[model samples]
Target: MDLSSQNRRQVLQTLGIATGAALLSNTVSAKNAVLKAGPAFKYALNMSTIRGHRLGFIKELEVAAKAGFTSVEIWIDIFQTYLKNGGTTAEAKKIINGLGLTIENAIGFAKWIADDDTTRKAALKQLQTEMDQLAQIDCHRVAAPPFGATGLPLLNLDILADRYHAILKMGEQSGVIPMVEMWGGSENLKTISQVLYVAAASGNKNALVLLDSFHIYKGGSSVESLALVNKNAIKVFHVNDYPAGISPQKISEPDRIYTGDGVTPLKQILQLIKNPDQPVVLSLEVFNESYYKQDALTVAKTGLAKMKAVTAGI
Candidate 1:
């Protein structure tokens, strides 16, 4: 049927308005989905937690994939085993990307805070090597633990800070950021104050606060402690849950728990981070033999579930 020009124009305008309204609704739906995430669910399994499985890098990658984890943190030993067993860097990357996961940051022993020039240089070179490995995996950061320096009566805090700055300079050159972690039981930087002090000394933009759930607890710091840290300075958090029995004074470092399964103030701590948009990967970093005794998939799956439930309230 032929219609008047005015009627045709009016009908087209109505259709356009209706279509626009529907599009707006769809957009809001997608936005609500994202906000419902509230924050990213970048759950990762720490290989150390699943150490009972005795799985190496490739096997752990498979286990993580099967268990529905998109990423994991691997230790230096795992990577060494991978390369020792004819595992190529390219092959590892393919396995990771194929399963859609990341190497994340590694926990390695490096004494960048030392009094000796030779030792410091060696440490920097070691950091460089670690960064090279991370770069090959397309990872942007490495976790540097202040290990192997204890029992030496080391009073060179300034020297160590300087040394860390040098390592960070090297890391920056290679497009890697080195996060200085707080070792709860260390003589120095055993608490957040010390870690923050060292991190502040670097004065380099790449230096950051690497929060380990267990360490934070052991440091005698509370959930409120997160308020004191510069949100921008926090690189990422190493998430794990642990009971109070695992005191900072003892129990060694291999007894972290799945989130919400322990006494840690997980939700309050999570709520502490100022910005939700800043790439905070809630990596499930545990070291419990019990969790490892279960299937690696079970460990990952349970860790993810617990983390979700704990953070859900926040």
Candidate 2:
């Protein structure tokens, strides 16, 4: 073959290789990029830890925003303070959106399931009102105990599921989801089996199950149970650790610690439920009083870093 013809063939081959390499780079970036837990399922420190000391809602929000959490969980009381302080729901929305953080879920402590008809109806109405605020603030989930007075006896679950469904139906209409938290030391859905039973019985499309590592560990749940849970039904995980001395029989909720500070198998739990299709927000829901005394911003950043490292091995 002539030298010019050979050179032309070589140039064409190099151009084709370059084009393929560019497409592969784009594909990797778009789809299979090591899926860093990113802000998607990244840590969100619950503002409740600093509640009493921080008193004002906006002040606490400032702490979290400055801490760089990119997401957070605000309890009902904090949100009420925001509204009362002339912070309109729209204003709260703006504050969060401007900081590029999302509200993972609102902790509205209401007992939607009760033995009495009156209390139950009242709770549902109250939940609807709360949902209205949650809707305004761009939150999609509300966390609550399984339908009784705060930390009290659960209503007949058979009876409770129907009532819970009413709340779920309300959520469906309003575009919010009721994520029932696994309370650490409660007769109502204390174990994974019980939580599953209640969720299955609800039969509502909007029913969401919230997982908290501290609560799950305190409740004496097995790691294998994590594998069995319906990943789709899980909206978020409150990552924290419980001390070993706490009795499952006791009413005391364990003073939760940071992710790696305790024995919770956070990585194993992650591997069990690492469904790429499902989006999960890992929230730092530590109820520890000690951490509250430290700078809330430092606590938030530290908690996120600990979780990031824990999930790295998985």
Which parts of model 2 have CA positions greater than 4 angstroms off?
Answer: 1-40, 147-155
Q: State the displacement of the C-alpha of residue 314, model 2, in Å, after optimal TM-score superposition.
A: 2.2
lDDT to native, each model: 0.76, 0.75
Least well predicted 10-residue stretch by lDDT in candidate 1:
148-157
Regions of model 1 farther than 4 Å from truth: 1-41, 152-156
Expressed as tens digits, the lDDT of each residue in 1-314 for candidate 1 is 45798899999999999999999999999899787755544667777778778888888888888888787887877787789889887888888899888777777776676556788778777878878887888878778777756545635566667767887888888877888877776666667777777788777777887887788877676667788888887656888877776556775666777888778777777778635656567787777877767888888788778877877745
lDDT for each residue of candidate 2 in 163-230, tens digit (9 for 90 to 100)? 66778888987778887677656667676766766777888866778877766766778878888888
Predicted structure with the largest TM-score when compared to the true one: 1
Residue 75, model 1, lDDT: 81
